[model samples]
Target: MDWDKLRIFHAVADAGSLTHAGDVLHLSQSAVSRQIRALEESLETTLFHRHARGLILTEQGELLFDATQAMSKRLDAASARIRDTEEEVFGNLRVTTTIGFGSIWLAPRLRKLYANYPDLSIDLMLEERVLDLPMREADIAIRMKEPSQADLVRKRLMDIRMQLFASPAYIEANGMPRRMKDMTQHRLICQAQGATQVSAGAMLVRELMTYAVERTLTVNNYFGVLQSVVSDLGIGVLPDYLQQDFPQLVRVLPEVESNEVPVFLAFPEELRGSRRVQAFRDFVVEEVVAYRRARQIAAQ
Candidate 1:
């Protein structure tokens, strides 16, 4: 059987009409019709029944459609693997990551990656919104949440810990809260976009507030919130790793609630065996592991 004719038949069956299939495939309507007819003739079975509304798939057509769907996916995977092997690690890689991490962490390391692989090109897309990997919106993704799709291969890179912190000026201005109830007298900064008020910081504050005092001030970005706290505007929760950047900032509570956000690198499962994808994945894992270890030693 001609694969081209089968491909055309699959498109028409999926679209429900030759005209619609032609529009999708960027082929002439007549060409689509011809291909479908040829496919039906080769199979010696009527795959679709013509109706006033459109074409309806026969029972045989449904079975064929299922088989073709699997076949098409396998073919695409095989083709991608072959291309990856034949070509150098010189193609453009589309990477999607969170804005803060992309800018502060990944961007700096990417220069070394480029220096190592001079032929490789990268397109970094930094956004808060998660892109669809199955839809091919991005080639690779660095995300806090692990993707649930079975078609994706995910590797946990690191654990990011959240901590409550405030500048010395803010602490001095409001007076240090020895207990939770004392926080009510001081201002608190929180993220507006977050759904729950019970963040790691909030939980610690609320717990302390139960015995001491409490108050609140919500904001969006961590950097902005930290800046406000530094200027004696209020106190907020920030990533523990970020404290090194602001020497003036101090951990608010000695016994604050801490939670680890798992950082992951994800790619389509089909591309897991591809040479280029594997190479990049290995490089990224190595870099992140080294960075995490160095950070641990520094903290010690």
Candidate 2:
């Protein structure tokens, strides 16, 4: 149970190659191999199975690796907490959200946040999968639905609805859909039916597909769908929030819309006092409020 040897073993097990682990640890491959051998001798067990391709963890090695992984995450959480001081918000903050919202909405508005806290570093993870917050997969998450995990500090940010949109050029060429049935005359762009998306968005796409549009383009993520629409490809089903950023996009078939999808912001309860988390939370709340106000003003 030498801590140094355990560290080397973790690095090798994680990388699956002594040379790669050596590169990361700044040690020679022979040196790393010596440490692993010492650790195995101390424990009287084999840690890895060697092969031409690389190393694979033995059953005992898997158990030890699991323990080391937990230890590493705990150390990271502690380091983050220590780095976060009350007087300054200077540290890395991992924020996870769907690709569409992160790319189209949040990324554009992040400059304001950076202006306020110039020292803050943000790692924005954009994907469809929900990362585990409690285990430190990500520090904070902005999800379409309320997080169901235990020991989470959650806040409802806003609700968004899926609606149809098309560029003015596309609408002019293809003609606007005066009614739902008019969709048959134009091409449709949307997230593929089996793609991972919020239930509300999928429902809207399904309802639109029922019209039997002749030409269709289906992308896996909303960013792609928005790009296609912006390119004058076809009418697309997209979140209503996009209107503020994409003024050129005309809302098509104003009467058609989807049920609201509630957006939530959440973090581990243990990070309740983290200044970095607080700053990000406050920044996001302000952005959402400003966006809402902008939409209201546009309506007037």
Candidate 3:
């Protein structure tokens, strides 16, 4: 089999568009099309079913893609091992996490990581959808819940909970709810039940909705909910970790909270020897330790 042709085919299959594949491969669309044609002729089979919308992989294409995907993963594993040779960490590191956690917590502390490794490029993907680490969709993931995927090296970062909070101004104006039933007197700002969120967080919001509050504001993510709460919109169901940065938010009905949600940092087994991953993991661990120690001191 032609390795060059296979590489082009893999890129087209991964991108599902000749133009996109060409752009990524730094070749013209015509050049990419010619290469695909040659590969199809050499294999004596149609790899992709051409359509107006985009290309779809045929059975033959799927088979080839599967092999290519495995090869890609192995190459990545080898690359990671090679990167462990030097103490210097300088390369693109793709990290994924929830929007709330990334924007509220992780993004603020990234300066230190950059300071330590000035040449490092960090791509922070903040979304609720969990990217497949093993598939190389993301190099590392900080998830709100324990990852169940196999062949992942995981670490528990901390325990988080969904609790009620409102800005001081909002609480002063609306009056804090003393009981669950009292929530009916105030507007409840939360991530809508329909939004993509952790099961535990969704359950917490769902339980809050059961109170049949007359006025409510439902946003898609915690960041939006927090924004509304801080603007004096209403009481928000938010993660406890937010309190560290948003000290102006006052806890409401402290007794009413969700079961603990475990925050975890995870990476593919392939990245076990990656210096970039090691650097990020150590930085996060150190930050978490300092955060916990500070919290304990505040309590004391």
Candidate 4:
């Protein structure tokens, strides 16, 4: 197969117009069209459906596009790994984690990481969706549950539990609930049961709702719940780690909390030698250790 033709085909298929694709590829429209024609003749099949507006991929084209897309991703992965020299850890490191953890816990600590590696560029992807680490959908992932995907090098970072919390002002005004059943007296803030959150956190919300509190406020994520709680709107169900960051938030009904959720940091096994991966992993591990120490001291 001709790599140049395939590359041109990929560009044409991606852009849906020879002119647009050629503009991107720095080739004339006729030259791009010639390559596509040569590619089709070599493959003995039409790859596109010619139309007035733009080109649409044929079935064969779709298959080829899929292959080309995978190839591109693999090439990108290889390029990234090659740039990850042992002497320096300075390049784009795509980090994926849950929105709650990314925004609340990991993001704030990134200031220190930046201070240490001033030249490092980070692409932080905050979402509940599990990205394909093996396929290079993302470079690194910090997930609540263990990644069952093969070919991933995973390390348990820590454990977290969902607990009830409220602002001190809210607690002082509404009085703290000493027991799960006492929650009926105040507004209960939490993530909706259907929201994309860890199973343990969802289960906690489900169990709490079984008490049938008189009033309730359900948000899509912990961030929103935390905002409501801090605004003194109500008590919120949030991860225990938040207490370390927001000390003013008072824990409520500590006895009623979610089961432990294990946090893991993972990257493709192929990235074991990647300097960027090692740097980020070490930074996170150090931060978690420091966080644990701070909490231990606070407890005493």
lDDT of 4 by residue, 255-275 (tens): 888899999999999999999
Q: What value does the lDDT take at residue 140 in candidate 4?
A: 95
* Top model number, TM-score: 2
Q: lDDT of all the models against the reference?
A: 0.74, 0.94, 0.90, 0.93
**Using lDDT as the measure, which candidate wins?**
2
TM-score of each: 0.61, 0.97, 0.91, 0.93
Error of 2 at 39 (Å): 1.8
| Per-residue C-alpha lDDT of model 1 across residues 1-300, encoded as one tens digit per residue | 788888888899888998999999999999988888888888899999998899999999999998787677667556667777554676667789876567656777777787777877788998767887765667789887788878899999877766677878777777776765566777777555353322454455455446543456666555566667777877676666564446568787767655667788998977776666776788888887787777777779
Candidate 2 Cα outliers beyond 4 Å, as residue runs = none
On TM-score, the stronger of 1 and 3 is: 3
Can you rank all candidates by lDDT, best first?
2, 4, 3, 1
Q: Give the higher-TM-score candidate: 1 or 2.
A: 2
Model 1: lDDT equals: 0.74
lDDT per residue as tens, model 2, 1-300: 799998999999999999999999999999999999999999999999999999999999999999998888888888998888879999799999999999999999999999999999999999999899988999999999999997999999999999999999998897888999899888889998899999998998888888887789999999999999999999999999999999989999898999999999999988898999999999999999999999999999
**Model 2: worst 10 consecutive residues (lDDT sum):** 205-214
C-alpha lDDT of candidate 3 relative to the true structure: 0.90
Sort by TM-score, best first: what order?
2, 4, 3, 1
Worst 10 residues of 3 by lDDT: 77-86
What is the lDDT, from 0 to 100, of the residue 270 in candidate 4? 92
